[model samples]
Target: MTEPGQGQEPERAGSRAERLRNWWRPEGTWRRGIVLAVLAVLLGIVMLLHSRIPNDVGNLGSLLETFLPWFGLCLPLLLIAAVLRRSATALIALVLPVFAWVSLFAGQITDKAGAGGNLTVISHNVDADNPDPAGTSRDIVASGADVVALEELTSAALPKYRDGLAKAYPYHTVQGTVGLWSKHPMSDPQPVDIKLGWTRAMRAVVTYHGQPFAVYVAHLPSVRVKLDAGFTANQRDASAKALGETIAADPAKKVFLLGDLNGTMNDRSLAPVTSQMRSAQGAAGDGFGFSWPASFPMARIDHIMVKGVEPVKAWVLQPTGSDHRPVAASVKL
Candidate 1:
């Protein structure tokens, strides 16, 4: 019933429509490439602004730092896809995250390789209920720390730590659950009120190698997790702010703080102290160096921070009988 030219024109139009649909449909490789590119761009921005922005998004910082290194895994996957799809643009996008990670940790690399100058320090959260006080003491003493600070000291466990650490640490002071065990004599030891019940944080002046330095040992309140509340980091943040004020008031220029902060250095909640102090591990550690819930460490909650000391080496010790691992660092005053 149709003319020959009219039928041929309809067929041509149908074919053109089919070709357009095929061109617009996204294939598997193309979809993956787009996703990788977007992720890389977002992660790059996060890295770029990490220092400027406070990491104190409740428990968000802790969560991110715990899983941050894992993000690097996506890099390899992206690279493979880029090669297979021949996506030069997508490949370039992957470089953003790599650069961001390097920028965030670049200072640490240089500090670790630098020469040591004069002090050795150790920091640990000796669990209040630890069963092996002697073993904990032995491990710490073996670290050769000129000054040792301990948090979570209990009345029952205090004597045990003292007796075990007596040979190496002659001068020491206990303020509530926090204490300082030093190889040199201590002067002006006093309790610091971090607004936690009783006294769980304290400060002391110790003369190591004839040089005077203000030392602080603190056990910030533990963070909690709940279904309703994702991460309860409020108490820790308040305590950090109070502690920061105390440190800022100190007369000594050279200061050291050691403890189980219950938060990572990357966490913005601890910005009060973190802003002023340099983390020993972040300055000189080899890897992620997590130290928490000793059964499986996903975050570095234990820290050794210095105000006027240079770190030579920093590392986490093997697990004792506590829920957290001890962090040790060799430094120069």
Candidate 2:
């Protein structure tokens, strides 16, 4: 027969072992899953916030904004997993980020149906190495815009553009690589000198339907890619700031700014200009209307912005000879 003391020791050791095993075993696996789902939802919210941030220095901000929308997709997947696992708490937690993202983008969605206007303006990059400048010019003329702004006008190709555009646009001016063509009479045509050495931006006053309005055409510096730095967009951002200063000084209440900004309207770095002006596309465009590297346009780098004018319709034209597609819009004063 076993002694009483010996029997008690074995029973105690067995109890201790069972307690340790229970502790090591996964407790509330559903709870852990819920934590993961919540994390995913929070990540999505952060991405949505990041995308809305404007580009301050240039490409760096734009690069971040470009991928911001993808974040929203993550939340839905996480929600699905949470539902499948029956983690009701995790599923409910996702509501916070979902509502947050919606609140941020709700304005953009609602503002799309813009008020109507009576004037039309067009802006195009018309790449410097465009193979068919003539074709591109013809396309712009056909747009029936009261004012047309073109950027990246190389000296070798300016005459071709002029010859092709002269018939439709009677009054025109070229300041370095930037130019403005108007069906109406234009006055006070001059270079804006956005960049110190290169005059790739200009401004003019156009009398459209007998009303004089200030029009600015600009081509901000292009950004470059570097392995270490990602995108070197500082020059473009600086140019945008300078352009903003110029626009602020303009005495005209009604103004139109057109160009290849080398960034997007979503980019916060451009707040200097974006806050003061309004994008025609954002006001009336039906879709994203991407216009870069014309082969497969993914993002809108070209833009037409107006102040004290009404935007009625906006769209991107088919590619011609340039790497960027043209953007056109109709507006009224």
| TM-score of every candidate relative to the true structure | 0.82, 0.81
Itemize residue pairs with steric clashes in candidate 2.
54-267, 54-268, 54-269, 55-267, 55-268, 55-269, 56-269, 118-332, 119-331
The residue pairs found clashing in candidate 1 are 55-268, 56-268, 118-332, 118-333, 119-331, 119-332
- What's the CA error at residue 184 for candidate 1, in Å? 0.5
lDDT of 2 by residue, 118-231 (tens): 778889988878988888888887778878899999989999999999989899999988999888899999988666587988989998777889999988888777887777
For every candidate, C-alpha RMSD to the true structure in Å:
6.4, 7.6
How many residue pairs clash per model? 6, 9
75, model 1: CA deviation in Å?
2.4
Model 2 global lDDT (CA atoms, 0 to 1):
0.80
Flag regions of model 2 displaced more than 4 Å: 1-29, 32-39, 48-62, 73-90, 93-97, 106-116
Task: For candidate 1, write residues 1-333 as lDDT tens digits.
Answer: 866687787789998877556643465333436766787788777666654544445465555654565566766777787788765557788889888777665564443535654667878898978999889999888887778888888889888899989999899999998889888889998999998778989998988767888999998998887676667878877999999999999989899899988888777668899999988888777676788879999778899999987877788889998889888887877
